[model samples]
Target: MTTPAPQPIDRSGFGTTGKFNVSLSKRYNFDKIFSTAAWVATLFGLVVLAVLLVDILIDGLGRIDWAFLTSFSSRRAAAAGILAPLVGSIWLLVVTALVSFPLGVGAGIYLEEYAKDNWFTRLIEINIANLAAVPSIIYGLLGLQIFVRWLQPITNGRSVLAGALTLSLLILPIIIITTREALRAVPDSLRQAGFALGATRWQVIREHIFPIALPGILTGTILALSRAIGETAPLIVIGAVSYIAFLPELSPKGLQSSFTALPIQIFDWVSRPQTQFHTNAAAGIIILMVVLLIMNASAIYLRNKFQRNRP
Candidate 1:
């Protein structure tokens, strides 16, 4: 004999038997409140960012000109330019990249691909995270002590090399952290496949793992460099001069000469009572922003290209 079919419940408050019957309108309204809150918060942050950029553009655009970009600093408003600081900033970037990239990548590889989940590795991991969180100014102080004083013979006291070394320390932890995350993101199956094909551990990391992780590493390095470029306090603490008048050349004498970066130049200009200097400061800011944007864009392009070239 066939069993009788169960009757379907009706919802005119008739056959519904649950203690709580959720009406669609009530549920929709409840969800709407949360969705609105999330969107509002995101939009608020975006609006603030937009306002800041607009304000900067409005204030700084008038200061940019061909002469302003290429001339050296002077006491007179008509003669002062950003040449020295621009050169100094370029030197800082090149040196920092040279010193930081290999060390950071190596550390990342050690941590991600090789380190076991032992107490020592755990401790190292914890310290690296903590170091990343430490205030940048503290790195400045450490740099002042280590690079400026103890290593003065090598860097010649607050020179471009000293500044680069200091900045490297400041960004090293960040680079390593980003690289480790990138390395970790590669699928385990890829590694397993490499091993299954009789590839050595080193070969697997060198050929397969690095190519996949390269994009992420490059992204992180760019971000780290961006942070380094904008840094003023550490450079100040390391005694980067603000009144440099000549472009930094690649010689020992040039290295020993006083230097200034874009931020330092801007700070110097803004601190002056003259309105023209303030305008110059604004110009320097715009230049700095442009350079940073270009660097970030290049990084993104490299990342995309690498991804497309991946096999």
Candidate 2:
């Protein structure tokens, strides 16, 4: 015969014979307090951001127009436009995406799936994590020494390509880490199932795992690209000009052309003593935000579409 069920004993708020015990009540209360605190913190952050955004809109909304977007920088604030830097920023985004996406994702896949855990791998992992936290200016200096000077022949010395490569280096570690995290979030059972079905490792990743992880991968890529787009120090260190009178042609040759980006342009404007330039800087900030928003929207759209395409 089955032994009598253990008596529900009150042992300091554990194993109680009630719908809810003291321990559960305490835990529930703790969770409620934590959630309330989190909600308050989130609301505070949103309020601050909203206030800043509203101020920027008021100061800069009138300044943004077709003429402002299409023209080049000029001494007259009314005539100034973001044409050069805008194009340069786009080019940098494209080039940096090209450079970093494959390398970062591939490295992450290899490290997570293929490389056996060892002292060497752990050291590499430690270095990558440390690198992600390094200051942007440090990357600028490194870029100055490597891409701008040592590889000047290949990078065409202070060109958009050089800036893009530098930005790629800046975000590569972040992307790799994010990719690995996304991959790791997949259940181990998926891999086991694939192997049980006689699939190769690569086949498992390609056919079953990668699709599930793709959305997360895209999110990480978006964050990395956003950081690259707003970067100024590296571009400045690599000699991105403040005034590019003309847009670089959209060709392979253009990759090596001198460039500027939104942050660089805004910095130049804000540095000037003229009040109008400061207003223009605000407008530039708005434009930069728009570009970033558009990029993110497109990526999100694509990610959603990819998900919908799946069975």
Candidate 3:
């Protein structure tokens, strides 16, 4: 059979010679518009952040010196320092880390590795997620009632320990959620292989799962602690004294000693009508931001190191 002759190509808008003609101006314009919008959105946030940072630095840079770092809060802004609040914040971080890390990680391990998927487990998970979203002030009230009033013998009502406990409660749900996600990321094959090699479940998790998940756990914990560091309302409700002039002793007694934090001190300074105090508040803000940045940098370094070393 002979093949039929090919038909002429349709080129209705062009000359007799077959040539394709197309216009992509509309699509090109749409892409350009979307790209510009995205760029603007990204820069908008960075611009605001830059402006605030510059303003704070300009207001406070001259105030930061050795005296500002060493002296305690005083009526005279020039003589005032962040010694008490800074020490209190450090103590609070230590206590909160000690209280929250083990509990949150253990709970996450049990839920992700041991617990059967039942209604009770589901209910607990749902409640935890909801609690994470609850306002920090609510946790403060809970801590005040339970840790301060109810367990006053130990917490000493409105002490550093009490504040730490409150902050721990506030960050517990976040730690738990982050831990469970990290645990879930571990492959089941690793567990099965360990079991086949005569290792028990506990051994498998202790040796295999924990090391792998540590980076993520650390990152989450640091971020939570950073959030806690900036919290004001919870500490205020739990009675973190705003006018503390002395550092708490670093001993058992210190846990019960009255304390203040950077945020509370900043709030106090900002509330005052004196311009000097406002400048002092800006200095405190700079310190707080530095602390947060350090923590975030640590998190990033740890995450990267672990990711590089992962099998």
Candidate 4:
């Protein structure tokens, strides 16, 4: 007896007796809608940013000549410039980086490579993570109390050093966290191999792990510094003045001198009733943006270069 031939599959459901089945095309309409929505969301931020940039450029382009950069702040809007605030910002950044970078990187190395994994170490890690999320203003308040009031002789109240210290504290958690992450990204096999070769732990970390992690570490540091540069609340809390007609003296005494930053100056300008001051504020914003762009570009360049040079 011959077996009955198997019937052909009706994948198309086109036969008269075939039952209806779901079609894959049913989801296409939903996918199209979601794709369009995502595109709109992405463009929305870019559109807003473009509009802001165009407005600022239109208002401030003519105000950004050399004279604007060199002249001091003036009651007359036409004569007002960013020289004092600009210099103060530079000094603040220098101090902040000098203090924060070494301390942050050292703390990260200790926590990641040296610390015994225990309750105390875990607690410290948790606190650092929490600190990264703390408000900048709180750091400013801490600076005000510790650096300004408590250590008046050293920091001087409302001074560049005070502001720098404040900003440094503000960015320290970020730096530490990023550094740890960078170190952690290095493969464990490298460390093991270094040990297998009879190298010391410090030698392995310093010679092998750190070199491999340097690019990420530097990128994170630059990004953290960028954030510090833009911070206004912490500086304000640390008593940064809105007006300083003279340049900082660039000495220890200068570090203890009263100062203002670009953000503070812009805030002062925008707060004034005069329309020309508003225009000046726009010009200041343009300058601040340019500085930020340069910092970010440098970070990208350095990160890429180091990555390329890595074995």
Question: Top TM-score: which candidate number?
Answer: 4
- Write one digit per residue (lDDT tens) for candidate 3, span 141-176: 999999999999988888988999999999999999
Candidate 2 residue pairs in clash (backbone atoms < 3 Å) = none
Clash counts per candidate, in order, are: 0, 0, 0, 0
Residue 302, candidate 2: alpha-carbon lDDT: 72
Error of 4 at 34 (Å): 4.1
Candidate 1 global CA lDDT score: 0.89
- The C-alpha lDDT values of all candidates are 0.89, 0.91, 0.92, 0.91
Which prediction has more favorable lDDT, 3 or 4? Answer: 3
Worst 10 residues of 3 by lDDT: 15-24
Q: Considering lDDT, where higher is better, how would the candidates rank from best to worst? A: 3, 2, 4, 1
1 versus 2: better lDDT goes to? 2
Runs in model 2 lying further than 4 Å from the true structure: 1-10, 13-38
Distance from true location, Cα of 308 in model 3, Å: 4.8
TM-score of 2: 0.88
Consecutive 10-residue window with the lowest summed lDDT within model 1? 13-22
The candidate that wins on lDDT is 3
> What lDDT tens digits, residue by residue, belong to model 4 across residues 1-311?
99999876776665422332334454677789999999999999899999999999999888889999999999999999999989988998889999999999999999999999999999999999999999989998999899999999888688888999999999999999999999999999999999999999999998999988988988999899999998999888878888677888968889988999999999999999998999999999999988888888988998899889886
On TM-score, the stronger of 1 and 2 is: 1
What is the per-residue lDDT of model 2 for residues 55-153, given as tens digits with 9 covering 90 to 100? 989988899999999999999998999999899899999999999999999999999889999999999999999999999989999898999899989
Candidate 4 residue spans exceeding 4 A from truth: 1-35
